[model samples]
Target chain A: MENDGMQNGNENGRESAQSLAASPLEVHDLTVSYNRRPVLWDIDFTVPEGKLIAVVGPNGAGKSTLIKAAMGLIPSASGYVRFFGRDLSESRQRVAYVPQRTTVDWDFPTDALDVVLMGRYGRLRLFQRPRRADVEAAHQALQKVGMEQFANRQISQLSGGQQQRVFLARALAQDAELYLMDEPFAGVDAATEAAIVELLRQMRASGKTVIVVHHDLQTVQDYFDWVLLLNMRLIAFGPMETTFTNELLQKTYGGRLSLLTEVADLMRHEQRKERDPL
Target chain B: MSESQLLDFFLLRQYNIRVVVLGTVLLGIGSAAIGCFAFLRKRSLVGDAVAHAALPGVAVAFMLTGTKNPAVFLVGAAIAGWLSMVAMDAIVRRSKIREDAAIGIVLSVFFGLGILLLTRIQKSGAADQAGLDKFLFGQAASLVTADVMVFGAVSLGLVVGLALLHKEFKTISFNSDFAHSIGLPVRGLELAMTTMLVLAVVVGIQAVGVVLMAAMLITPAAAARYWTDRLTVMILLASIFGAIAGYSGALVSYLAPRMPTGPWIVTAGTLIFLISLLAAPRRGMVARGLRNRRNSRKTLEENILKTLYQLGEEQGGMFNLRTASDVARRRRIPESQALRGLGLLRRSGFVEQANNGWKLTQEGETQGRRVTRLHRLWEVYLTEQVSIAPDHVHDDAESIEHVLTPELELQLEALLNRPTSDPHQRAIPYH
Candidate 1:
């Protein structure tokens, strides 16, 4: 039974890969707008397998927007995304996302273990509690982040770096193939930064694809194997050795496109006009 | 009712009173259990909006059906509550109007409409409208067995739903973004939560009415939160608190003349919340105050022991006793605080009183030495690594000495190369 299962999985994988692009994440002409204001413009990229990819850009360059759109948190204006040559819904169990820590209220009445157990929520059906195996996985995930001692600590009682580690542990409990993290190292201490980098390398070594929205450009070349430079639009994407040049970094952060903001404002104005029509 | 009758009622000798109490408690449990989620979501005002918005539904249900049926009122209230939620969402999404403003608008508009309809119905002189105005502030005294059954069944359903969908509810309340990313149907779960809130409000409209119904939902949850960091324990505590408030309301209304059940229930809930705020352990005011006092006492005790040790060190023999006045002269703290600290330390066996003077015991000597070492080591660190002048480091190190852990002390010792003396040239006592 085991042999048949393994063989069937490999055959299915080959069939799916041949049917469509086999990239871990593939986005084509992705456009996302809030109301009528466009944030990301016609982004096109496909991440290679088993690499630590950094999405680097200036502030308001849609770095977080790209991840949110890929996760389908926000509706894309026009585009399609494929994960493992299939839709996100089909390969959802093999995907994990770690949002920015600030996006949630840390004062919520839940502890580290309870928060990590949320990673297993997707695997359970409706009206089902997390199984013993799921709790074990969550505990193991916490240990991996060096937060096992704080397993019962309230989120509000944790320091900033410890809270970030708890969030990473939650994602680790998902045990996914593709990981999308938003600013995982932002505002972290040196120890937390090292731990996160180590975790990312381990994930990459195990053939899991990791994508991060990175802020520090100096560390990008060292931490990421691939780089996708964005500033409201896809500027360049390739292996970090070639694409992370000084000129490209300047293009991404130096003189941003003022036209995108102007057009976004105009689009919002038009949308308002259409709404009232008085 | 007489005191004896009240006693009988409390002892459950009365059947009608028992059912009525059970109904109110069930309603309270349902509302407060879900209210924990609403409270954590920082949407406490939404419950108020939903309750107020439920008023018109009860009125409209009666007007449409011309019967004051409990089921009909619930349906009407549920519909009105649902519409209010939709209206609030639309106002937030479609326009720049914030959610609070939308809730305020919807709550007042729907309640005003319900009042207008009720006034019109009262004037029409409909026979069934005799006690229709009771929905305004609830008439717990008039609740029949049938009405109690309706409230009980709906409240049970809400409790069951909360129990079954706990994981999804907690995830969404804590972080909807993560829930959405994990494919847990974030919007649907939110809608479910609001729907449960609507049902809770609908069930509460009769025994507690619209105005005071929100207290049953919010007060219990708010009080329960101070007692626990775990959501499950919080929910259970909220249920217990709500049930107590509900029982208290039933008792007051039954025994006292002119006391409304709804307001009594709310008053009782407020009392419970106040007690929890003042007396609950860990997060309560009394506990926090005690903890702070204990911490400061330890600091004082440690400082006193260090002072006595330092005085003895300067005299060449560490076992010699020092006068309290001499001990007080070494530190800048108040004399009373030093004496008090010394008294506490002596009682704890860290120090002893001998020949009308104080001396450190062996335990106290070790502790004082550790504190002294940490202080001097920090002074060295400040001057060497932080570039602070030696004289300027003493004041900063004074407060930090007591809080430094043994692990940190080791780290500092390693980092400072086991400094022989502070910048003041005094010996850094080795433990």
Candidate 2:
């Protein structure tokens, strides 16, 4: 019986490797820490290609940390992330990241078009300026998000919804196979939210993968095909039909385990004491 | 001076004058170029702090090297500025102190250290220290040809480097996290930017000095911001402003022969800033103030128009001539204000003289009807849609009536389905 179980495990690992080749994103045993305290621990997941996925969790549940760590924006404590069965550095141009709108200086002196043009920076060789074709591509992206009319307006003058659209236009200009967005719907108008969802569906239909850090629980069933429910650690991740149950949501958002929180607090206290003893 | 001498000076052929002007101009361009990024990052004060921090470095370099070499001072100042930034970062990360407090602490502490070093150097009574005091407030007239050449070359290098890496620098400054996500080495770009800022501060110290160089970095950039919203345009305008400040400051110093160049350059830059603040299109204080005044005046005229329409309606819509005192009483305005309103109305052809009082003209009657219609429509809409008490909405409607355009009036009418009366039973005028 032991021999049979070992053979079954090897076969399953091989099958997963094959699946990883087809999936846009695969993470194994990922852990992220801030100031020596783990925010996300032992996270393992795979995102199916050409599917719209939502990563949902409570505040401080490390939903943003998961995305940032996978994109190498933040250092991970352990494990690695692969894009299409390859390391991120090897597949960078094929991926794009749309950061939260609030993360940047809105008063920056560039217009909508110039910002979208920055999306092409990754493809340009060093010391080479963007050409006319790059400008055309940026204009096309702005048109896609219906922000072409605002192409010349400085970013500071843009309304919140319009600013969010400009950021999405920048992401579209990247023309990548995989897209990751953090809170694209937060603080946007209802119309902008609808436009973003429509754009995501279109991208999925075109065989592009999109992952979003979504905060609205009410719209999860309507907006996403797959869901990853997380609260500091992976609670459940699968197709929304099989997962996304009330029981799993309760586990993810229900108050943290008293014992687990107590342990975390104690560990943090010990680490602080070790760093600077009184 | 002879005409030929004047011509020579204008042509920039004189060695001393040319060197001073060229050096100062180059310094201006480089500082302003780098300053654009610093200002956008909201780190304008960092330049001031770094400049002040350079003082102790200059003193220490003099003490260690036993010479007054500009190169030594440059290296020393760069190190000091870079160290202050590192310390500030550490304080912010390791302690609970916020960024503003950290910067404030670093600025004052470093500046205090610099003052102490300067006093110590003065006490030592070194022979070469005669000109070192000039660094406190620069003397552009004292810049030698060699210094001019070095400054010019470095300025060119700084500008060229920035131009070559414009996209990368812009990306990092606007959004570092996004840049990192795209594998752009944000940390490395930041280090390079900081280094460039330090270099800018260092080169500017000779002409603007540690005390006033910060102004050169920030004032021109700020002034340019008022003129244009584009970063490229703002940088170019700032460079032009800086060059003007430098040239005129140098010229004045040359003419006076005793005044320092640093304060004058800063003063000139401040003058440009003042002009931009008061006169720049769209964003200037004067333009905004004018727009507001015109709007308020128009509101007052429309309110008067509505009052006249109400009086005419009370007397069967004939607009019979009413006395000034009566108009004032009905409108609850002072007699003087009523007379002024009447005079303005006559100028605009909205009212005409009739015996002892003013009466609305045909055009005036039309406008009066529009204003009264707007006031009543707003009152009705506020009471119906916003759920305001009928009595409480008059004040809001009074203000809204003057500001609502024709399109808004149409929309309100459509929404309310052309209500004939307000909740208070006042007739809603229609055109």
**Which candidate gets the maximum DockQ versus the true structure?**
1
- The residue pairs that clash in candidate 1, if any, are none
Tens digits of per-residue lDDT for model 2, A1-278: 21121111222434565645656887777888887778887777767778899999998899999999999988999977889889988898899999999989898888999999988888887668999999999999999888899999999999899999999998998899999999999999877999899899889989999999999999999999889898878887877876789988998899854555566677788899998898
Instruction: Show model 1 residue runs off by greater than 4 Å.
Output: A1-20, A273-278, B256-258, B308-330, B349-362, B379-396, B415-427
Quality of candidate 1 docking, DockQ: 0.72
The stretch of ten residues in a row with the least summed lDDT in candidate 2 chain A is A1-10
Model 1, span B6-59: residue lDDT tens: 788789778888877888888889899999998999899989888888888888
**Candidate 1 CAPRI-style tier:** medium
Off by over 4 Å in 2: A1-18, A256-263, B1-13, B256-258, B305-346, B349-431
Residue A112, candidate 2: alpha-carbon lDDT: 96
Worst 10 residues of 1 chain B by lDDT: B252-261
